[model samples]
Target: MTTASTQVVLSLTERMPTTRRYLMCEPRHFTVEYVINPWMDPTTPVSTELAVAQWTAMKETYESLGHTVETIEPVDGLPDMVFSANSGTVIDGRVLGARFRAPQRSAEADLYRRWFLDAGYRDVTMPSRVNEAEGDLAWTGQILLAGTGYRTDPAAHAEAQEALGVPVVSLQLVDPRYYHLDVALVVLTEATPTRQAHIAYYPEAFSPGTQRVLARLFPDAILATDADAACLGLNAVSDGRNVVIAQESTHLIAELRAHGYTPHPVDISELRKSGGGPKCCTMELRG
Candidate 1:
């Protein structure tokens, strides 16, 4: 039986039509895996129960703000399916379902296909060959930057952009640890109502290419502080003057204030542990 899908996953390209716009998504569904990253190994022990509570609270928070959310059902055998961060590359009207780079998380495509189709995304396309998940994709309206590192490849990124008929900028990752794009980058500006354009990426540490790309993207760029970047400050949603950030990311919250913006912080530690911060978990679709 086919389940009815009412939400329309929006594309960044459409949001970028103007300057700054307002866009918010309801966090109705989310998942947090049992095993955290190998690097952040904590033998202290964590519970899936606690994680779900956080996820549920996050969803409720979004609902309070007035947006609908859908639970992306888990596919058998894939533990990470609970985390719908690695799903697709959405821009304009195209919703390109992703192919996972991690062999363990590859089953997400078969699971997510229904959501895209049911949402009325007809221009869906896949790589003729093979590719990584869309979580590795960074959409900035004008340029779709793909991280060519652990979770993504040249071919996969190229295929995604081609399918969408858009130009892509490949950010070569020297640090193998920050493999997935979301870990290192997030589009900070999607505040516009009609056209939701992002502020692009700002590497807190330092990256000349990163700065150049951002400078080129926005004429009057809002430089988010490095302290905020450390706390995933750069990974936030901006509604013009209002900004929503992760609770644990302290530096980002302060930086947001310095730049003259009201910051709304919520606990997203569970989401971060599962390889998604704030931006990864959402695909904005407003017609």
Candidate 2:
């Protein structure tokens, strides 16, 4: 039952793995002390040891995949610091530090800023607007896809664009559960000279107009099921070919394979108590 259209589609799905550099933080003091997102419940008991173990496994996974993984020192009392992807958005060696919207996480921004500066990143700029960095901003190689209506302010979209010199497309999130853009959308293949960029996202997480915009922009984008999205499947990190995702997201894993992606599943259940998955714990250092 092979069709001409299916053959063409399969032929066009040429995927190649690219070596990536990533920044991560060990969940040494990780815990859900307060509620910032719907996924966080302070009442639920958390295990710091379990979080560390899971994080270590994830770090190893990236290393085994031929990617460079860098770590940042975690400050005490900032349990959520483990979600290092929110530290900032780094593009072409230019660093745009995060400005947290929540008071509980405000202190984290400066710590991350200092890290970037001390790490020899001379072009680091701390944003004035309330932006949670990679939590709401996703770089698709060609343009930046930014999410607003939750943790990040729409105004930060312009700030990011000006700072990074990349065109930014603002997508409005309507669901609090999918508060950050990373929780709802993942850039699968970043656009290059020969291929168009591809993404996988949950339509329900975005507003009607925003959903339409996504559809128009990525007609071949994979759509996540409700069950997959609930497990933070969209909160994944893809190196063009290999996608590091939550093991609980079985459906998304299957879909990723159908699309010619090799999905590497990791158990970050302990960290998910604080609303983070693989992508939340790993920030890509693009240059």
Candidate 3:
């Protein structure tokens, strides 16, 4: 007999791949210089050289898969700049810039805001409330799924809605290890005119209410295993069909395949020392 999850997978139609534009920053200065999230540890040694090599390979993988990859220059002192997903949220050509919660990452907000303005984004709005941009905000093609209870202030949810002109659904993350919504949930197939949205998430990362909300929103959503979640497997980037994920997430990779999605695993273990994975390094540029 097929499991409920497997049955859900079998019931789904074929998935289609779309070419996406992504913004990535090279891990030139990536290191565990400070500890913020549970994954970070300053005492542990980090290899900047290895980080760069791994990041380069991930970027190349996106390009090889018919996606456009753009880069932003990395600043020396900001080691976490490599995880550009925290920079801002972009949708329909409008940009809502991030306001970091941690003082160490405060400077990144202005830099990313400047990049948006420089790129000719006239509808850019710098958020006043503490919001980590795409790190806590995810666009599901139908609505903005916002996360709080950790990095992003709940007040920012309304602010994001106003700035981006979209409906926002707020979810509270309970686990510090899954502080960011992107770390706990990955949108598998964004809602389109012909299809509803689909996602894969780690239920334990969310509060009970949030888990129930997620289930109601995505009844057929793939539930990730504990081992995969521990490896930051839910921190993935999906272009409707192909999923770029961490190489360490073996079970999640198999689940993606079973669900008719291609999983491209990249080893960013060095960057994971600072609490980031494939999705953390990629910022989608939607227009």
Candidate 4:
């Protein structure tokens, strides 16, 4: 790992020229109320107060760094609403809505749509197939990396490409633990004209074919260990330079610093019990 004094640290503006905007939700009624994914276990208890405090801290962190942060009202019986990244994908000033696989989260589709429309996202694209939106789809600065074989259907990738007018690369997720693409992959920066950015991901979470695809596309990408993946460390949010991640993911943080990226660790342990961290609670609003 690179030592603090020797590390090359880039300011947010130098790394990302555009102001990063995000949408988040308050953990007002957040809980493991239903078991929709492997991470959720309703039998376990959840501290709503702690979840709120952690989420508020995350929002403030973004604002403190000169980024824009917006909020969506949390609805009752929608515990997973706190994970706003699943709501939809915003690209090129358009919102591509999500079609949740589970009925427990199906209502979220409409809730997100209403917010998008009211927020002046007139070019909203609704999907005919099942898609979890940004939860499985993320921009790598050059292309859209879409995940399937779990929460999002393979067909949704085609729809996303058409709706967003961008090239889409489909990667198959084999591990149930990393059900969402965002859980296994962390895009370091969007590709710019002068430079190609990189990503950090857990190869074990993907199928062999998808792993090979990633290895081929990103030969110099960072690889997360099983321990780090289990801590949901790969599920991170980066503004090209500074990365906000789970405080417990020390190894990953060291790796990021070694790669000249500053890691901002936050204690979202309460939210991690529900299988989420900084990235899960944040949805980059490109539109």
Candidate 5:
């Protein structure tokens, strides 16, 4: 290989970036799913039930921690509609309109345009397909890792990356459980793992080439134990050092604390039933 290429590869390997941070929805927006989730049932008239109370507590907790909350009216189809924080595909000043994949919330992307504009994010462009969502995109030290399986495709990720004038790698996902890359992996960058980025996980589904790519980028990766990985919001957001993991991931809680990180645990058990957690509900623009 060329000397220049080798140097570039070496430099790119295992280098972590600062953890990006972001805000969550406020009280009004937090109570969204109460109206939409029941539509999935299609039985009796849709009801908000106890979601209002849940959203209230979640909003208070988020605000108590100093995060700005976003609010919006409940749209019919997208139950995850309130997690506007999850719609986080930004570069420079541009917002990558999430390409919707799940029909249940296909309209979520439909709602992104207005949200982006209202949120003051003007430079918005969508991946080729009109269905990609914000949660599908994962940034590993500026290198975009797109997970394609049931929710997204390689072509979709390629289009988004190409348009953004960035490098991207399709991290093919093993379906049903690890729906998005964020759910299966949380990027521990210089912000969280001390300047060494780790694509934390327990899956053995990558190809040799893919494995090589990962190793070359972040070599200090820790393939987490199932318990540490799954319940603790394994693939959530972090600001290089601090993380927002699921409260259920108790062991990881100890690990992060031992490493000197100010970890925040969010109770997302209710969302888990719908294939979501911390990462799925929010996207970190600045960790």
Candidate 6:
């Protein structure tokens, strides 16, 4: 109903400029090496060549828009390493390392920590609790919107809040299909004093209480259609102006465009076999 928050979201899509910087990992060695998520089935065949080609196309898409695409060296045996967004999240020049729930991904934490350290990020906090970094926790301006009940532990929310000096809102994920918060919720615009934040999410991913909380907090949020949600529509990467989303999420693409956003759809179907999408493959280096 034409609320102030709705107005802010509309203004954001109309006025916010594109972000020029991003960090990604080439899927050169990407494959469904193991079953870490609901989508990943070790028995099913995966094409590593196709995954790499699609990822390269995505990187080139960003570069064509005049954005800087920095990459991390892919380590052998870490198939999920291609999902760079799960590594860690950066805020205020400080990095918070992800403590993965699975052993396969836990070792990735150390590599990401080392990378951040070498990259000159001094205040890197190695989390003790099980948190998949940006996959579970995302920053809407300074406030953290965290998800739990699948990969990230609820206690880690407090730890992140203490480390980042920001308020953290914990949302409980109920569906295993949308394990990570980034897969269920997409932060479209950051909150500020004069403008409200905007987000898009699949309601079925969260518990009833969490759904109520989300509805109350973001009354203007775009509720994703069931078909779009199944296609991992919420797993989209937005640069405030341009939103790179999954090609199969047709409903979501139309929804974003109706809200004045420029939707850049890309085919990452090969990587989706491992439960990773466009947002999963990209991480924004917030300074």
Q: Is candidate 1 or candidate 3 better by TM-score?
A: 3
TM-score per model over all chains? 0.73, 0.96, 0.96, 0.94, 0.74, 0.94
Local accuracy by lDDT, each model: 0.56, 0.92, 0.92, 0.87, 0.57, 0.86
Better of 1 and 5 by lDDT: 5
Count of clashing pairs, candidate 1: 14
TM-score of 4: 0.94
Q: Write the per-residue lDDT of candidate 1 for residues 1-287, one digit (tens) a residue.
A: 33222111122223222222212222333343344343233344445565566556655555555556556655545545654556666677776776765566666776676777886779888655345444567666566777764556678767876788778877655444455666566665443455445453445432567556656756544554545555555556544444556776666566555444556776666655554555555545423
lDDT of 3 at 140: 89
Global CA lDDT of candidate 4, please?
0.87
Clashing pairs in 2: none
Listed per candidate, the RMSD to the true structure in angstroms reads: 9.9, 1.7, 2.3, 2.7, 7.7, 2.7
User: Which parts of model 1 have CA positions greater than 4 angstroms off?
Assistant: 1-44, 128-134, 190-211, 218-231, 238-242
Worst 10 contiguous positions by lDDT, candidate 3: 5-14
Best by lDDT: 2
Residues 154-181 of candidate 5 have per-residue lDDT tens digits of 7777677766666787776653455566
Best by TM-score: 2
Candidate 3 lDDT, 1-287, residue by residue in tens: 89978765764556888899999999998889888899998999999999999999999999999999988999999999999999889999999999999999999989988888888889999889999999999998898999998899999999999999999999999999999999999998999898899899999989999999999999989999999899999999999888999999999999888888989999978989999999999999999
> Residues 1-287, candidate 2, lDDT per residue (tens digit)?
98977865784478888999999999999989898889999899999999999999999999999999989999899999989899899999999999998899999899988888888999998888999999999998899999999889899999999999999999999999999999999999999887899999999999999999999999999999999999999999999999999999999999888788899999978989999999999988887
The lDDT-based order of candidates, best leading, equals: 2, 3, 4, 6, 5, 1
Residue 273 shift from truth in candidate 2, angstroms: 0.4
TM-score (C-alpha) between model 5 and the true structure: 0.74
Model 5 CA deviation exceeding 4 Å by range: 1-65, 85-88, 190-196, 205-209, 285-287
